[model samples]
Target: MSNKTPTLSVTIRTGRGKGAARRARNEGLVPAVVYGHGTDPQHLLLPKLELNTILRNYGLNAVIDLDIEGTSQLVLARQVDVHPLRDYVEHIDFLVIRRGEKVVVDIPVLVEGTPMGGTLTVQEASSVEVEAEAMHIPESIIVDVENAEAGTLVTAGDLNIPSGVTLVTNPEYAIVAVNEAKSAAATEDEIEGDAEGDATEAADE
Candidate 1:
């Protein structure tokens, strides 16, 4: 994760219910709640545009320093609710977090390098869950295939995760595999069969 934690200034919302939420949206604000650590959930209003930009730049699990009316609180963007047909963020749920606290997050898995000739690499899982300090969450985990032979399988446990991060995903889970590439002759035969089927359909018509 990037070391830069952007700060957002938000205000506590006193109004409740759908009417108040709708009014907030009309005013270019997003209704949100912050709750964690055995505290009461705080209702707040955040700038819609600013929050969207932050999420786009920092990702869904982005951590932020929330300036709630004057008090500063570190939080994680735990959940986001988007309008189904409008495609805009409607509400957000923030989780209050501490620097050293461990949080479970899904990190992207990237496969690097090419497999041996006549073989192709297939990624079985795109992301894996990991538990890491709130301040030290990694951007992603990489698994190198590098000239691997056919039938080679890479599992979650084989990943070279960064120090201080623990994999929450099952160690036996397959992440990627190298498989034999289909032969050109086999593809051609399938194409010929499709053409023959088309010709028979035309005759029937």
Candidate 2:
């Protein structure tokens, strides 16, 4: 994660309900709510393009400094709702957070390097849950499979987690595995074997 923090200036939304939210979108703004730390939910309007840019640069767990009508509040982009057909951001839920606070988030897993010849690397898990400081959350975890032999299993415990980030997922959770790639003939044989097994089972019955 980069040390730089993204800032967004927004205004408190006055209107309510679906009508207001639709109007905000028509004006290129996304309706959002901020709530956390036992505070009442505050409705706000965010720039659609700016919010998308921040998420693109920092990922879903981006920590943002929201300038709400001249007051700055530290927050996390906790949830986002998007239009299923139009593919635009509809609403967002921001969670208020403080500096040095521990937050649990699911970080994406990235595979690096290439496995040994004739073996293919298969990702078993896409992301893992971890707890880290609000400002120091890692964007993703990397697993190196360079020259890895077939049958080598990479578990969550094997991930290269940065210091200060505690893994919340089970240590035994499988992440990736190196396996021998199957050839066309081998695939055909498996299909034939299944068919024969079905016939034998029917005869026995």
Candidate 3:
């Protein structure tokens, strides 16, 4: 978790429509809306390059200080829409937040070290949900598998989350498990069988 909050400069969006959105993008802006705290939604335009840079550095769970015109508001990124082919941000939804408020968020799970005895590690969940102070959200939760043996199971409850964070995910949900590694001969045989099956299907077609 980082204590730093990236700041973004934004302006009130005056127009609404695909054409307006297209024009905003053409001018290197991203269309976004901010809503929460019993307030009306505010449509705004953000600098595309600056927003991308912030996301790249802080991930999706980033807390940002939105400097709209001259007033500042603290917010959390609730949703983001991206261009599938071009991979650029198309739109964003931000949630207004206050200091010291606890927010529920999904933090990425990271595996550390390797399992022992030539076992293969299977990750069942890539992220876990937790409730924490909106200003103190963790970047990721790490699961240590150092010297773990086959048949070892790591569950969400086994994770060591930072203090002030409460687990919101089911405690028994499996995060990672170690299984016996497949032999090279077995892998080769499986591949051969798959190839034969594909050929037979092709012949039928």
Candidate 4:
């Protein structure tokens, strides 16, 4: 949950095309691009292990400082492309940001406390969009369901956001809801009964 920006070492990349990208991967480097802020896109190469470690520790919304041959740039991870089956980072798209700048990002929604009255709490949205300072983004928005009764609904408007953050999601959008828990055994029995009745009708026909 730390807002501290991580600094990564990157190098300018000159090669292009699929063969070049494959060669970079074979050498344990990830191809990435830095863009935005009225600047031309810069193709770069990053260490595979270091990039993965930062992403794993800080999550996708992490704002990081890239040290490119001694020059530093503050950027946010906008999009990440990963290898389909190998779970490795293939490419990343970064957006440049400045201090005090507000950016829209999707923040994870966390549920706290269980609903009352033997009800089951179901999450409708796992994340919500918000606008916050690029360097001060909140880790996640928490939804407190303590003592919530069956049929209780929590909407985007009900979320408690930190000061200086603005909710971009629709206020009426449902985030979570409480409903009575259904008996799994009973449901299984009903399905079995329906199947037997269908079989009997087919035999009679």
**Which candidate wins on lDDT?**
3
Error of 1 at 28 (Å): 2.6
Return whichever of 3 and 4 wins on lDDT.
Answer: 3
lDDT of 3 at 85: 100
Clashes of 2: 0
- Model 4 per-residue lDDT tens digits across residues 72-137: 999998999988999899999999999889999999999999788778999999999999999988
lDDT of each: 0.92, 0.93, 0.96, 0.93
**lDDT tens digits, residues 30-64, model 2?**
99999999999999999989989999999889999
Clashing pairs in 2: none
TM-score of 3: 0.90
| Full-model lDDT, candidate 2 | 0.93
Give a tens-digit lDDT track for model 3, residues 69-129.
Answer: 9999999999999999999999999999999999999999999988896799999999999
State in Å the error of residue 17, model 4. 1.5
| C-alpha lDDT (0 to 100) for residue 179 of candidate 3 | 88
Which regions of candidate 2 fall more than 4 Å away from where they truly are?
199-205
Off by over 4 Å in 3: 189-205
Where does candidate 2 have its weakest 10-residue lDDT segment? 1-10
